[model samples]
Target: MTQTTGTAGDPPYLRIVATIRRRIADGELAPGDRVPSTRQIAAQWGVALATATKALTTLRLEGLVEARPRIGTVVAGSSPAGPAAPTAPTARRRPSPAPDTEPELTLDRIVRASVEIADAEGLAALSMRGVAARLGVAAMSTYRYVPSKEDLVLLMADAAFGEARPADAYADADVPEDWRARVEVGTRTLWGLYRKHPWLARVGSLTRPLLVPNLLVHGEWMLSALDGHGLDPTTLFDIHVLLYSHVHGLAVHLELEADAEAATGQSEDQWMDSRAPVLRELVDSGRFPTFAKVVGSFEDGYDLRLDALFDLGLRALLDGLTPVVEG
Candidate 1:
């Protein structure tokens, strides 16, 4: 039986690179195929953009892929055309306790260790020094494996995403007859991941997308859903962005609430209770009858009301967008 050990030594980015390299070598990825972008890598790996980029850069240096202008990175023809070589004894091994107590730094070890650090303390706490401390090694030694903090983060993000296998269940679900519902399923799945790791909301920037394979699954699904809608390429891209923004913007609030609850140890209900007296006093002053009426009933609370709001907003947005997409 294989004994499962916790991730205590490896950084996530290197593992991400290794996973992708293995996929390429195993013929899962073919020549000229585009790799995940920096943002996608970050989302998938659950690390910062820096680490995901580093993982990609490592692959590039190893002659696995070439980054092309405009077209993005594509798998290099030089990438091995067969299954990856068997893992060496050292590669299959995990870190063991030592008298000096330092873990051997492999790309896998570095990335896995870094992921554990971020998962526990949050990404803000991740740094070369922090990761090195976890590995019981000098910060400079980590550079031998990851080169820089940025690359390390990129790897972390991609690896996190790679953790979730694409839903094979969706294969039959994406039927031509029910594409809208299919798109919703994909969005909600991603939203659930964000809810699990609320910190994920802060990782991917709206401006600079990190490349990772898992994230593109959502995009690919949405684009395919719009295929029969008769939208132009630009319109399809716009619709995709709009749908993404709707889900992500709402999901971001989940992260904020998580942080707020952690810092205050007070649920939104409790916080509202503390604020109620002052709010009522101001509203009852006869200057804001409208406000008084709105808060007159807190029995349902914001959480209860949020579901209605989501349904209302989604319908309104879709109502307006449906024509444009179908046109």
Candidate 2:
């Protein structure tokens, strides 16, 4: 059976590219139909957004899809007549910067470019040199703005976190009143940020937390929810950390999964399938009656749902803490 999600050894991006190519060749997608956005592709195929972006990039390179200014990514040509290429823009000339003039670069621009790079490719693929190359300047030029790659990563993370608001912020102009409800919304908002930016999860840890201002904004919101609940100072803070960890702990897998797919060239299913023989023997050995029975009971094989796990973990954590906070 052709597994829709990461089933073959081929990278997820390649799978996405090949699928689009087939649709084009088979005329299901057609020449001018607007192709799915990266987010859409990620949602539909359960692949990382970076994987989806790479697939679209590959499609562009193969002349199967083209980016239009207002319409977004679409099939290359109306009739497959030599893949539609981007229309040449009206040429404009710029006075080169005076030899003595410093480059028109700023810290914000540097961080923005770095974030863009990390978003499209994982953090490992990011570098001072790469960022400079992307910004069309000398590698050393980036140093003037960002002292080092590590510093750049922190700034990039802060900027990314800055893009999103606490879930409570998205509600009606008036904030949610109940502490539990606010905490739930706040935690989910953090979850959404991690979902949108997988790299953020790897940016910091519990011990070495990212102390960016925007992220602190999120923390304050969560902490405020549990404030004045009669809980001790340490317990209130502990609850906040626990909830953050639950979301972040699961999010780390997002990047790791992408990295694994690229490294092993196998989807999770494909990797698991390789070990099927061993699993089968263990399940059938009859030595572990309980394990075998559990395996045999699945009407449909177990679904490894990180999302469901996230929700369940959040609920369970909240359930455990509700009394502690109110007690």
Best by lDDT: 2
Model 2: pairs clashing at backbone N, Cα or C within 3 Å: 9-265
**How high a TM-score does candidate 1 get?**
0.59
Tens-digit per-residue lDDT, 202-265, candidate 2: 9999999998999999999999989988888998898889999999999999878766764555
Model 1 agreement with the true structure over 1-327: per-residue lDDT tens digits: 011221234467657776787678677889998777545566777877557656666577578887553234579977743323334434543323334434566788888867765553345546786566455565467887788878888888676655553354456654545656656666666665654544466667667776766677667877887777767798888888887777677767765664465345578889988997898689789888877777676566545444455556667777887667655
Provide the clashing-pair count of each candidate structure: 53, 1
- Give me the displacement of residue 120 in model 1, in angstroms: 3.8
* C-alpha positional error of residue 305 in candidate 2 after TM-score superposition, expressed in Å: 1.0
lDDT of 2: 0.74
Q: Please give each candidate's TM-score.
A: 0.59, 0.70
- Determine which window of 10 residues in candidate 2 has minimal summed lDDT: 86-95
Clashes of 1: 53
List the candidate 2 regions with Cα displacement exceeding 4 Å: 1-104, 167-171
